[model samples]
Target: MKFYKISKDSGKKIFHFNSNFIMSRVIQTDKTTNIGCMHLEEGGVIGYHQAVVPQLLLVIAGEGYVRNDKDEYFKVQSGDAVFWEKDEWHETKSDKGLTAIVIESVELNPSLFMPLKK
Candidate 1:
């Protein structure tokens, strides 16, 4: 068992993130899952990218907009959760700054649910 406290100063910034935004990776487990936190200042944008695995973004502070491959945008705020399937293209932006929790899992698969349908 493990416990972690989320803090801005806890993790290292992701080198590939846009300069206007800050992304910190807090936890990684055996190449299967990753947990991170991101902060987007006003006018900041996270460039479009395809998800390598299933992901969930949980907005914890402020507000922002998420853009999908179809060019559609969705407004999100604190307590809002967004899910992205593997290989889905998406991006994010914030006009008033935003903070969120990011969770990704490469090993999660449909097979895991097969036994639950019983």
Candidate 2:
């Protein structure tokens, strides 16, 4: 699994029309892709499982913990993005709550567009 940052801190500023805003580029896929929004309520958990395809999870709100095959959990919050390889074991959970955007595909190469988390 790999972790990255997609927050405004890593985005480009747009000054179009005299308006200013930061746009974070997440990913681009030429192959079949699946995108969805995930909402984990307080004490919610996405049980450990093998990823059907390469998966990327972008935290848009709240905070949570993510674990890989080693079963060690790491804290994740808004602006964070987690990437799991095909068939990789992983899980996500939150004690309070969290919201995220999930992207799944075989052509994902986030390193081309996102900055890796330190």
Best-performing candidate as measured by TM-score: 1
State the lDDT of candidate 1 residue by residue for 17-116, as single tens digits.
Answer: 3445777778788887988899877887777888889977888999999977988898999988777889998898899999998889976553443332
Candidate 2's residue-wise lDDT over 9-117, tens digit each? 6655544333233445566556678766666668767777789999999999999999989968999999999999999988888898877788999988899999999
Q: Please give the range of 10 consecutive residues that has the lowest summed lDDT in model 1.
A: 109-118
With a 3 Å backbone cut-off (N, CA, C), the pairs that clash in candidate 1 are: none
TM-score (all chains, Cα) for each model? 0.77, 0.74
Whole-model lDDT for model 1 versus the true structure?
0.79
Cα misplacement distance, residue 117 of candidate 1 (Å): 23
- Candidate 2 runs further than 4 Å off: 1-30
What TM-score quantifies how close candidate 2 is to the native fold?
A: 0.74
lDDT of 2 at 11: 56
